[model samples]
Target: MSEEANQIVQINSSEFSWNKKDGVFHFDGAPALLFWDNAFKIFLSTIMEISGPDASNAVFETTGFRMGLLVNDYYQNRFTIEEVIKKYSEIYSSAGWGNVTITSLYKY
Candidate 1:
């Protein structure tokens, strides 16, 4: 990973408490609702190994589906995947991960 990718990974990892044994992410020390943006980042990290033409599509679909179950469903559809992507793009950019994008999340 590049330094920026490493930084993103670090930021994302610090946001949650992980249960390595169970492969779970917890908020406030509990398995509570994760924000949609956070869920998107987590799912995006998993597909870092993916590449080629459909990479963005893969990231979009996978992140959307996971967010639907982990965050959106619990909040009753307050936001969309597009919104999450746009919001996080700015966040990642400002955090020195400017290369990170909805499309680039999986492509790299």
Candidate 2:
């Protein structure tokens, strides 16, 4: 891992919130579903850019699977904080955000 990869990427957390009590995530003061459309649109654009038009769907599916793995491992105590960071770094690197680090993870 490079030094640049250790820096966290900044996002506006104010756009999203989570209710720990109910285990629910909200976006823009509403349920996450309301925000998914726009979020997916942005994500699809990046997917197309990275994987090209034809492979975007497959790439998206694979990416989702990898993310699930990371989350599952985290919840199952299969990875330490450093391990989780490394795994996420690999994911972001593959997704064309190699130089960026993620500062937070929201349930939504």
Candidate 3:
């Protein structure tokens, strides 16, 4: 595995917290929610059931693009560009989303 993949494999428990009274979980000081893969599947399925495959896919794609932009703005404001690039994948992986490797990065 690549170094990035290896980095993703390591999990630091101290980076996570739970507020039992509020039923909230936090990672790296940001509030988080857990959703099983099955729940995500059901979410897409429900959208497909209502809107059909193409529409559902489009909806998700566009929403994902916009959400990514918002996340980018948040990071850009708080971190240097280099820091954002370095920490982006690790942050998402730490959140239990999945590992992301930037194979060929190009800076403008």
Candidate 4:
């Protein structure tokens, strides 16, 4: 949302859903997932609404990473970035969307 912040904010859509029973999140076709249990409550934008595991799919382009470089800030506030990616990839394991894929990530 801010060039200086390097945060590309996006809105949630139908692809993002909630699994109330499991307390996990599914986004953009990703599987039910959990991260830090409850670090992210709600990620809001004009078009998107995402939570926890679903939040991982929201990263369209470089956000804080880019902002950090711009401001000469090298530290990643959250260490789970890599872990989150791994988990997402793991859930995707050889399973294709089978034609139901988001052509582009929403960013504003």
Top candidate (TM-score):
3
lDDT, residue 53, candidate 2 = 76
Q: Write the residue-wise lDDT of candidate 2 on 1-108 in tens digits.
A: 343333233243224455555556544344543335568689789879987877987887888999788657544565566656656655445334445667876555
* lDDT pick, better of 1 and 3: 3
Model 2: number of backbone collisions: 1
lDDT of 3 by residue, 7-82 (tens): 1123543266666655666655566678899998898899999999889889999999999897776667678878
lDDT by residue for model 1 (34-59), tens: 35676768766666645643896777
Over 4 Å off, model 4? 1-14, 32-108
For candidate 3, give the lDDT. 0.71
Ranked by TM-score, the better of candidates 1 and 3 is 3
TM-score of 2: 0.31
Off by over 4 Å in 3: 1-14, 106-108
Off by more than 4 A, model 2: 1-40, 49-53, 78-108
Q: How do the predictions measure up, each by TM-score?
A: 0.26, 0.31, 0.72, 0.19
Q: Model 4 residue 92 lDDT? A: 39
Candidate 4 global TM-score: 0.19
> Candidate 2 clashing pairs?
9-101
Better of 1 and 4 by TM-score: 1
Q: How much is the lDDT of residue 8 in candidate 1?
A: 17
Between 3 and 4, whose TM-score is larger? 3
Q: Of 1 and 4, which scores higher on lDDT?
A: 1
